[model samples]
Target: MLITIIILAISAIFFVSGKIRSDLVALCALVALLLCHILTPEEALSGFSSSVVIMMIGLFVVGGAIFQTGLAKIISSRILKLAGKSETRLFLLVILATAAIGAFVSNTGTVALMLPIVVSLAMSAGMNPSRLLMPLAFASSMGGMMTLIGTPPNLVIQDTLTAAGYEPLSFFSFLPVGLVCLLVGIIVLMPLSKLFLSGRKKREDDAKSGKSLKQLVNEYGLSHNLFRLLVTETSKLAGSTVIELDIRRKYGLNILEIRRGDLSRHRFLKTIAQKLASPDAVLQANDILYVTGDFNRVKEFADEYAVSILDGHATEETNRNENSLDFYDIGIAEIVLMPTSLLINRTVKEIGFRDKYNVNVLGIRRQRDYLLRDLGDKRVHSGDVLLVQGTWNNIARLGRDGTDWVVLGQPLAEAAKVTLDYKAPVAAAIMLLMIVMMVFDFIPVAPVTSVMIAGILMVLTGCFRNVEAAYKTINWESVVLIAAMLPMSLALEKTGASASISNALVSGLGSYGAFALLAGIYFTTSLLTMFISNTATAVLLAPIALHSAEQLGINPVPFLFAVAVGASMCFASPFSTPPNALVMPAGQYTFMDYVKVGLPLQIIMGIVMVFVLPLLFPF
Candidate 1:
């Protein structure tokens, strides 16, 4: 018992450090318990193969497919479109929409998807992102309360009930208290709550930086690298497509655009140009290719392809037409370095960033200072926002990397990929099938099997382009964290530690009356959740709540609900939930901000849930 306590204490220190990875801490603790004979090998390894873990993996794939297909972005546009310019309307729309989506999806994924859109919307409406974000994080939690799978705690308690020979909660059982809690949360986070948030760029200010793309045409010296080539009938490139030519990879050059008719404006020239210039378009005779590359490769490509180089730079200063090179077609996006990004503490030059990624760093935003120049030498830090520039193809791929970098928002002009755009319906269908199979139990299928089918279908139906990308979409850290933490709950119960804790609660707090016992259950669960994953907290306390109920000779339902409700009240700390972490960097929220706002909400929720649980469940 003492060894277990010592192990957990050390693990908690690592979890709160913000230096070591949480998954690593969990793994170390697991290995320690196994070595100390606190747990058998089977017990230590059982968590890895748990149904809950598998279900989360399936959900991750399904969620990634939906995200990649731009479904979330489409929803963002439709809802915010109706929100108009009123911050109040936008606030309501954001909370309602994020909550609605989060109930069906991972809250972390929901927040990651919405953060960019909300930030952009807040900027457009001239409001600080923090004002909209706090409600967003809170509402996401509330949304998870609406369904069995809304959050992990709901599932944890439902399964716990099932294991104890009680009927598991139905899918919609969370609706009653969840809906009421959501309404109360909405009231608490009204627009007036903005006073507690940080001041940032207003809507009246130039929001182009805070809102959308900031084009820097000459920043990367791309002008000097631009070269125009005229392909003749004898050119080797005349019969090939841009992708087939692979000029970008072969010679380290970016083909900016392809123009046909060679400065001839016969009106048909526009039609001819349209057919031959896009990245997928084929090359033809009389085609003029606008390319950017090193000077040596530019000359080599022209010579090898039997093409002629156009002397002097093609600038809007010289050409007055639509095809004029006036800093157009440049793609720049803001990406924040993930706290766990490997690129941290290293200079951009040291990372071989430009050569490796084929993107140029325009500026770096570290706290208050926006370092535009001298970026290559400056060491990058976690949470630093970067302004990066590249071709549309190169820039769009950055959106796929949710692990190392948090892409702020996509540029307005960049088109969604044809595969992802078209596959949205397929992904939606798979998700529906998974939900129905789990809910209906039409064929007595295991819940994990349905998720597995959905995950497999997501990849098989081209919703995810490849297996590697599908794997990349899962948050391995989250998977490891949850899987590794499961054994601790089992160990606590096995060692009689959980019962000891529950006995203390019944003897000490329980003597005050059932209401006081309810408060203790609620407060204990809530406090544990603020510092650890809510799912782990629910697993630890749900049984203890049941044990307490047995001692008091009342229905366990109220106590169980208290555990669920209290565990979900993870608003008081930034690290309490993944949604909170996702929004912290984007909203520029401080720790005190969470305490100032979330602490009150947590206390209020405890009081409300404690007061109402007995009435709802009838102890």
Candidate 2:
């Protein structure tokens, strides 16, 4: 018992410090107990096969299927359109849509797709992005509180209760408290959010003034190296087309543009300078060639052919060709580092950021300042904003490698547009039917079986683009954390530590009545979740809360409710949840932003759940 208590205390310190990864901490605690012979091998490995863990894995697919079919994008767009330029309405719509959608899908997925849309809405509505972003994140968490599969924490508590020989909470068991929290959060956050929100600068002003071509050339040292030449009648290249010459490879110069006179324009009439020049344009007398490369190469071409460098002029037209758009297949993107990103503290050079992701790091935004140079050597930190240039295909591929990266702003024009997937309604139907079957228990099978069937149906119906993609959506963090932490819970029980802890709790607060004890459990869980993964918090605390109930000779249901509600209340800190991290970069939000807005809601939720759970469950 002393050993169990010592191990748990050490683990708590690690969780509270937030320096070490929770999964690593949990695994270490499990290993300590294993070497000490506190648990048999089967007991140590039991959580890997926990029903809750299996169902959470299955739910990832059901949720991914809904979003993969592009159902949320289509629906959320309509809701925003209905909002019709009202900032208040758009605010409500963002929260409502994110909340509603998040309840059914992974909040990270919901937030990833919604971040750009909400930013665009805020920009158009003439409101600061921060005013709506934090609430959008908070609402997503509240929405997850509503459904059985909303968040992994909910399942952890439910399964923990079942393992204690109690009837598990139903699919809709969380609805009442979750609905109250959602409505109250929307009401309170919408106005209070404005008081704390601030932007680094106006987005519109920054977009308009971003960087000019001449400025880029000066900074990149390209001046005097680019030249335009005119093709004369005596030129060997006259009458030959660019594609015919293969001038790019043969001459070692990238042709920027070709200007022709009105009389000679017929030779190259179909060209558009804004887009890349077509190789089919036939060279003609009086046609001007714009190219950039080593001066020696340009001079050689000029001397060999009947051409003269159009000297003493490098105007705005040339300046306009200075950006990455000048090169084919190059695209720029902004991505925010996740709070739990593995890239944190790792230098871009160390990670081979350029080669691995095929992106050139251009700038870094940390806090309110933007760092434009030496970014490759700067060690990345959580919430560090990165400006990168790469091919659009490379950017999309990078976004998929992990949850650590979230693609910012718009998808590239080169990216496949999110067309209305005709399979959306079918996907929605499959999801709803799965939920109904589980809630009603009408399938003559266990609830987990129904969930598995739902996941399988998603693939068979083509809800997800493919089976491989669906598997990628499963949150391996939650799986590993749960599997690692459950052994600690088992160690607590097998060594009588659970009873000892419960007796201590009862000795300290039993006289205050079940209300006070419930409140204590709720507040402790709530505070822990603000610093740790909510799933881990739930996995560790739910069993203790149930033991407390047993010691009090009352029903374990209300105590379980307290732990569930507390674990889901991750509003007090941005690091508390994934959705919160998603919006931090776009909104330029800081830690205090969450505290100023989320504290009151956290208090309100604590008060209501403590008083209300007993009435519903008769503790």
Best by lDDT: 1
The whole-model C-alpha lDDT of candidate 1 against the native structure comes to: 0.71
Look at candidate 1 and tell me the lDDT of residue 376. 60
Task: Enumerate clash totals for all models, in the order shown.
Answer: 1, 0
Q: lDDT for each of the candidates?
A: 0.71, 0.68
Local error of candidate 2 at 482, Å? 16
- lDDT of candidate model 2 versus the reference: 0.68
Model 1 clashing residue pairs (backbone) = 126-203
- For residues 1-619, write the lDDT of model 1, one tens digit per residue: 7888788878877765646776788899999999999999999998799876777677667667776665555555666679876777888889888888777765654665466567656655667778888778888888888888888888888887888898878888888878878887877778335768745543343343333331333433444456778788888988888768867557767665666543344321112222224345788788778776677888887888788887654543344243244322345677789899998999977866456566667668789776754556789999998877665556667776447787665553332222254455666676667666655635597767877888898788666546877897677776777778778777776777655665576568977777888889888888767644678778888887787777888888888888888888678766577676556655656556777788888888888888888888888
